[model samples]
Every structure is written in C-alpha cells, then in structure tokens.
Target: MIRELYRQYKDRWLLELTFDRLLRWNRWWPQHRDTGGLLCWGSDKVPPDEAAHTWQGAAYESGLDNSPMFDGVPFNTKTNQLQLADVGLTSLYIADCNALAELAQVLNRPAQAAELRQRAGTYGQALQMLWSEEKGIFLNRRTDTGQFSDRLSPTLFYPLLAGVATPIQARRMVDEHLLNPAEFWGEWVLPAVARTDSAFTDQNYWRGRIWAPLNFLVYLGLRNYDLPDARKQLVDKSNQLLLKNWRASRHVPENFHVSGVGRLPSEALNRSDSFYHWGALMGFMSLLEQDKAVELKKTTD
Candidate 1:
C-alpha cells in the first residue's frame, strides 16, 4: 500500500519519512516473534490492567481475534508467543520484507535492500517447511509439539502473496483447497474457515465469515500466479458481494456472511459494522481487475 501510494503520487519525501519506521517494524517481527526461525504472533509484557495482555493479546496481534486456529493453543510465557509457528504471520513477514526491500531500493539504499532481501529469502526457506504435501496446503505447526494445526483459514494462501510457494505447490493449494466447495470456495466464496470445519456454522467474526481484507489479500496473491479463472471468480464474487449489500442498504459492511445469506449490516447474524471503509475493498478488487484488463488491452492493441 505504501508502495502504491508512492507510485501514484511519486512522493519521495513520504517514502523517506516512513522508511525507517517500516524497516524497524519489519525487523521487530523476527527479533521478537521468531520461534525456531519461523515467526509466531506474540505480545510484549504489559500492565496487569491491560485487557489483551494475555494469550489473547497474541491472538490480537494475528488480527484474527477469535479464530479457531488458536483455540487451545498454548502461550509460551517464556517467549511471549503462541506455541504455534504461524503460516500467516511468517508469510506476511516475508511479504513485509520484500515490500520494505522495494522501498529501500527506491530510496537508493542498496545495502538495506540487500539485507531485507536476504531476510526474506531466509524466512521464505523456513516457511517452505510448513508446507504439507498430504494436505496440499501450508499448515501452522505447534512449536511445542511440532504438530500441524488441523484448523485452516484463508491465511494459508498468503504464501502465494509472499512468492514462497512454487508453481506446483501453488497449483496444488488452489486445486485441492482454495477451489474446493467443501472448503474455502463456495457460492459466497473464501470463508474464513473451511466449510467442513465445525467453526463454519458459527458464522461469527473470523469463525466462518467472509472478510474483505482476506479476500483482497488472497486476490493479490492469485495475481502472482497464472490462475486467471480463480482470479476472475474472486473478483466477480467480491464485486457481487459488495453490490448486494450496497444496493440493498447503501452500506458497505465490515464483513459478510460466508453463506451469502445476509443483505443488511443490521442483521444480527451478520455481525457487521455498516458503512465500514474496509468493506469497500471488495469493490476495489473489481476496480483493480478492470484496470488490469485495460492495461492488457492497451498492450495487445
């Protein structure tokens, strides 16, 4: 996003201003969250009065507050991280490194760019270990027990965004998981949890709801590969989701039902914040798709 901002506005000063802080944040993840070289979501010590100071704080850091992925996962107080080495956190960190590296290059800092690229490569290698040939997708592993979490979410597809999954691995993931009706793919599409998972019935926040950010991130990842069919489906369905609510109540929702059952944000089961800006990202995906189509047409013309 920062890169896009710089690209659109050509603001060198803005990139210069934010570069160091972004670099620090990229560095902080591995330094503090590293568990056997793969990252986990963690929290630093906080005051007793802090509501999220516990394991819940670590979950908060994952941005999936109540995801079943962390259910009964132990918190390593010693490391201040969840015992699970998260595929999502590690993949996102790699993406951050690559993004920061691009910013470093733009700022004419070759040494910093090299360092960031090296960090991304090292972590990318570690992330590859999370891939399960049997499952045909990456799984989060418990650092304590070295067991893979059976729970799955859209975050697993983040490896594509990080450019870590090989073409074959990416194909397997898409064919066996992403497009599977029993899992993430459906009429509504890309549920936070697989339809087969018990959590899907909850239809609560992260349990099985469709989140715009998840769809957007996964959509970005799909753009990295040759899956035009999947990409178009995602863009079309995301646009449909946005329009369905917008045409009904003139509201963009914070999230949507995985089953495509709700129309208004006021619906109790939907549990969405009406008119949330993030929800508009569903529409933004279509805009991006349209922009790409125009660019392709111009090139072919």
Candidate 2:
C-alpha cells in the first residue's frame, strides 16, 4: 500500500519529504551489531560532550513515552548513541529502507533503488542477529556489552511488521509469545508491556496500558503473514474494547487500561484525549472484519 502511494504520487510533497528523510536516516549505525545498530541523535540536536551520558539529552524515541526499558540506559544526544539497539526500531528501519527502495525503483532511479535495497538487507540481517531462541522473541541488545533486555513490550513483535522475521520465527513469536496467556494476551489484548513482566502490574504510562496504534500495526503484521485467525482475534478484541468504552462514555480515548478492566479511570493520570483519532482504529478494524466476512461468504457460496 505504501509503495502504491509513492508510485501514484511521487511528485507530492509527502513522498518528497519521505525520500529526503530516508536519505538522511544514515544517522542510524546499522553495522555496529547483529541484531541492529543504535540510532544516534542528529548532530544538530546534541552537543558532543552530553551525547554519551544522559537519557535527559534525548527524549525516548520509541513511542512507549516513558517505558522502563530506558530506566538506566544512558543516551548521548550529541552523537545519537545509546548503549542499546532496539529490535523494534531496527526492524522498522529495514522496512522503511525497503519501502524507499521500491519508491526509488518506481521513480526510475535504478542505482538509488539498489543502494537502498542493499541497506535494507543489511539491516534485516542485523535484526535477525538479535533473535533470542531462549525467549522465543527478538530483544534489544546493549551496544557496548551486547546484552539483551529482559523487559518485554508490545513493540517486540515489530519484526513481523517489518518482514524481518522468517516464517518459523513469526510462528514462534505468535504462538509462543504473543498468544501466551502469561505474556501479551488479555481480555482486550496486546498490552504495551507483557503481562508477566514486572512493568505489567504498573498502570503508569507505557508500563501496561493498551495503545490503539500498536495493536493496529501488529494486526497488519499478522495479516501480512496470512495469519487470518490471529488477525481476527486481535481485531475483534480491539473493537470490543473500543466499543465498550464508547458505549459507556461516548468518547474514544488516547489509550486504555490493560484488558479494559474496570471503568475507564477518571483520574487525571489515566484520562486521555477523549476523542483521539487513533482510537478510531476500532472503526478500521470493523471494516477489516466486514471484509473478512464477505470473503468467507464468497468461499462458502
């Protein structure tokens, strides 16, 4: 779909901006590790002295906002180096590179397409290097020590979205990790943090809340692999959670309590944008469900 968009409208400002961004994304170091490389801060953002020692220098770039994954990791804003390489970021980086390569090919830039494709393949290789057979998941690795993080988050499955995982790997991720009752699975599904992780018990921020966008991306990933059953499970659970909240309060929220437990909290900390656009992903899921039903009916007939 993204490739089609670029092909259809390469002259548009959006694609131009996208091309420029991918061209400049060289700030990320993909060769430093096998699982992925650290994305350094742009030279304009951090001073050389502060780039290696403080998380305060760089805002946590992963959307989890205040995830505990960076609790003690030092970030250098000047050089854009953190001690760790994120599996999610790496996988997405590979996907983006591949997308840009396709765009370049559409624009008749054969050399540019080849370069971007090579870069994408390299990043994909590093992403695979980060796999943990023991955990049945891809994990973040320390840039300096090559250690993997024990904490798990919904973003852990992003390799599927990036097409960085092989069929076997995706199957393990889905069956052994994603659907595991002790991990991501819950009544509403896909918490920001795994249910068994220590952070899961914390209702604060990205510790354990359900975010609409993450689930939507994971749903797309499942569909990419033709995992219709898994995809439907996520779509149904997501829509159910959204409708339950909407029926009760007549609002779409920015995020929600894990599993839709209890009433959507009224506390200031728990309160979110009452009508966030992303929460309307439930409507999108509804369309997907409808399409699936139509397809099923056709098959039966």
Candidate 3:
C-alpha cells in the first residue's frame, strides 16, 4: 500500500523533493540542511540541524529526532560530543533511537553486533535520561536547557516503537500514560501536544496542533512494544479523527484537536495529507483486523 501510494503521488513527491528538499539554480546540495536525514517541520521553523547544528550526512528520514549526519566513518564516542559543525545534531531523541533500533532489528534482530551495541547504548541513554518514570512517558529535550518539555507530546514512544523498552515499561506507558483519562487518551490517540498542557498554544510551537506523522510514530511504538489493546484503541482513534476531519472539511486535516475542536483542513499541503501521514491514520481494514486479532487472543486466553 505504501509503495502504491508512493507511486500514485510520484509527481507530487518529486515536486516536494524539489521545493522542500532541493536548492535552486543547479545547486548540488539541498537548500534544507542535509542532516544526513530529514528535519522536523515546525510552524515557520528551521530545526537546529540546518541553522545552529551540523549534519555529517547519514539521515534517517522516517525519524522525527534531531540527528546530525557526519562525514566521519563511525563516530568515535569517546572523542566526540555534539558539535555545532555536525549536521543531524538535534533530534527528537527518542524517535531517532527507535528508528535506529528498527534499523538494527531489521538488520540485526536480537544480535549484539557492534552497530547494534552502539544503538543499544543510545537506547539506554534515552530511556535512562529522557524517560519520566513519574509521567510514564518520554519527553523531548531542548538540550541547551537540559530540561524536558513540560508539554506531553507523543514523541515518548520512541523506545516502544524501537522495541527498546522492556515489556513492563511498555505496559505501564500503555495502561497509565497513553491510556490515562487525564493524560493522552483521546477520541483519537491524543494530539501531539495535549491542549491541557500549559505550553499548548494553537499558533505556537509546530503550529500548536497535533501532527499526523508524530501520531503515526507513537502508534507504531506502542504496537512494537506488544501493547495490542492500546494499539487497537489508538488505531481506532486515528481513523475516527481522520474521518471526523474528512466529514467536517471534506478532506483530512494535518491534525485535529485533542478535544475534537479543530477539524478544518490543513492550512497547506505540507505533510498532513493521509498519503503523507500514512502512519497516523491506519487504513480501516488493517486496524480492524488487528483489533480482531487482539480480541481473539484475549478470548482464547
């Protein structure tokens, strides 16, 4: 389906690459900083990767984390700390870990290869430093401040998505944090930033709105951690939100409000389309089937 979608929108994607990725006038490098990966889109924002940080060149496009691509072969951990000269410096710390883990899983599964080991180290640091045991969620860090964002965004599932979190941690996040009535539980899987959060402002930070791509990541992370029931609920919520937007606007919005308030069409054609946020709104069939599978397992058990 993803392949088919890509093919269907090949023309538009080429344009996105041109307008969003490339520089004009026969420039070899893209105008957007090549963090060796993709940059997070903020509302009128250029992530640190392009401006304050540097990219060495290897980027994970699927991730929303801040990573800098570097020219060196393998980053020598002992000799290296983050430097402004490197691209991919800033990342949604957890998202990058999950992306790396999946890459490791695909290439190394349960192996303890060198690359996997390095990734594991990162995973360890992420969980240890970034996870809020009290909140049962992961938080994004501004790095410069050394404090976690008080607003709870869905970026915490990086470890769960990456399969780095233990089953216990996954279950806690699912049962407590993500599903808690006071926390993230939503008609959909909750907004990128819960409106209830003090920092949530509709026009600020990343448009002060929910984002489909990040929603997609959180959903996958939960699923990866084997939180089947929570995953089902989230998938169902995603569809409901998508349909709600479609019903209201005759098309999907890039994101909706946690309280189901803003169902209007996305302001621009950026990344809110179903085709683009393919991760957030699960196709109805897939979500239903998975829910059925989980139900069947529960019944048998």
Candidate 4:
C-alpha cells in the first residue's frame, strides 16, 4: 500500500516538504512548515501549533521529546516561526528518497528510479555541509545562519544511516563516539546525548535516555557499513534493555534511563508513556536479524 502510494505521489509535490527541509528554497512555504516539522492541517493564517505548547518541534520530530539539542532554538514560537533543517531530518529524507527509488526500480520505471536516486545523492551532498570536523559529528545547521547547532544529540549518527558518511567517518563515529563509554555507551547503551556533554542527565527524556528507535537506526547504519559485530552488540544491548524493563514493570517504557538501564526513575519529572508502539520496534529487530541471516547465506553460497 505504501509502495503504491509512493509510486503515485513520488513524482508530484511529495518532495515539497523535503525540499523545504533540505534547502528552505521555498520562499512561499506552507504553514505546515512552521509546525515543528509536523504536517498539520490548517490555513496560511493559522495552523495547528506543536511548538507553541512546548519548545519541542524538532525534538518531537526526532521522537526524542525535550532533547536539549533544541534548547534556545526557536521553532514555531508565537514570536518567531523558524523552519529547522537538522541533520537527522535531512538524512532521513535522503534515505526515503533512495527507498522510493528502489520502489520505482521494482516497477520497471528506470527513468523515475534514476531521477529519485540522483535527487537522493544531491540531498546527500547537501547534508555533508553539516559535518563538523571539530566535533567529529554531524550537527544540525540552522537554516537562518547556515551555522551548525552546538547541541549534539543521538541524531548525529543518522548520516551513517543515510549512507552519506564515508568509511573513515563511520569508523570514527562508531569507535570514538558511539562505542565510547564516556560518550553514548553505558549499561543500556546509546544515550540520547553524549555522556561527556554537560547537558546529559540519566533518565531525562532525550537528554540521556536509551530509545529503541535510536539504537535501531544506528544498528541499521552499522549493518549497512558491514560492521556486523557492532550491529549485533547494539541489537543485543537493546534487546537486553527491553527485556529488563518488561520484566520489572511488565511493560516497555517509551524511553529507558541510562543509569538504570531498563528501569524508569520514579522521581524523574516529565515521565513518558510506559508503553508506546514506536519504541517497541520489535519487527524492526526481527527484520534486521533476518537480513543478517540472508547476507551470511549469500556469503557462504
């Protein structure tokens, strides 16, 4: 169903939001563009406000609500309506473009496939401008200043998932950053913020918590780069955390505390839903493992 929809709309205005996000080329952007990256319903005069209620438009888009990464970054505020172009959104858009290209190929639409692939590659090129050599991580660039955001979130690793990072970059990110105990790695693994960052706080949603989707994305990137062992380690840790939480609370929480691994802190403010489907990503794990098996079989064959 999704593939058919993609086939239908891939050529149309489906890329309008993506274009606005990647380049902000649209001078006359729609009101939905102002709503924290969410596609909301409304007119040019007034639209549903996501960021007005809380300063979490971009964070919400990343599924990490209240991540400090968006701190001080005005997005969809009453006083200001800023369109954020973060590395995560750009990379994800690139990935989506590539996926749609594959669907086009399956339908024997070579021209459409080539066009989508080229578009994806172009977006990937644009995404590279966000790389910060000093930080050794990709940061979000404000469309306003075209300057990178100082806040480093787990979304930094998303370039790898987009297949935009070079082999050397991926190695450095996975080795020096993602796997570093003082950075994202801990008991549960892959906190939202680097442990060395002052903003990092265990149990804080998106501040330092472990999220299944975040790890799953990194896992996909690791596999894409043929780092099977690292991918396995991530999958193992993620599964362990989920199982631990399930055993303790008899359900999975939206995000798990880095300090406690599987347990949510009772005293922690701004608690999340104890059970959310997006965080589960159960089928994602199965699909990844299955892909791994297929790869292994192909190699042996």
**Using Cα atoms with residue i matched to residue i, what is each candidate's TM-score against the true structure?**
0.96, 0.83, 0.55, 0.76
- The top-ranked prediction according to TM-score is 1
- The stretch of ten residues in a row with the least summed lDDT in candidate 1 is 261-270
Residue range 6-93, candidate 4, lDDT tens digits: 5566653444334334333221222244233322111222247645344454455456566776666655444233345677766776
Best by lDDT: 1
- lDDT digits (tens) for residues 1-301 of candidate 1: 8988998898999999999999988888878999999999888887774744478899988889899999999888889988999998899989999988998999999999999999999999999999999999999999999999999999999999999999999999999999998898878877889989998888888999899999999999999999999899999998998898788778788888765634334557438777788999999999999899999999999
Candidate 3 per-residue C-alpha lDDT over 42-117 given as tens digits, one digit per residue, 9 for 90 to 100: 2112365442222222222223322211112232222222211121122233344333334333333444234434
Error of 1 at 157 (Å): 0.2
Show pairs that collide, candidate 1: none
161 Cα displacement, candidate 2 (Å): 1.0
Scored by Cα lDDT, where does model 2 land? 0.72
Order by lDDT, highest first: 1, 2, 4, 3
Q: What do the candidate models score in CA lDDT, each in turn?
A: 0.89, 0.72, 0.47, 0.65
Report the number of backbone clashes for model 4: 0
Residue 126 of model 3, lDDT score: 40
Clashing pairs in 2: 34-126, 35-126, 40-80, 41-80, 46-78, 51-76, 51-77
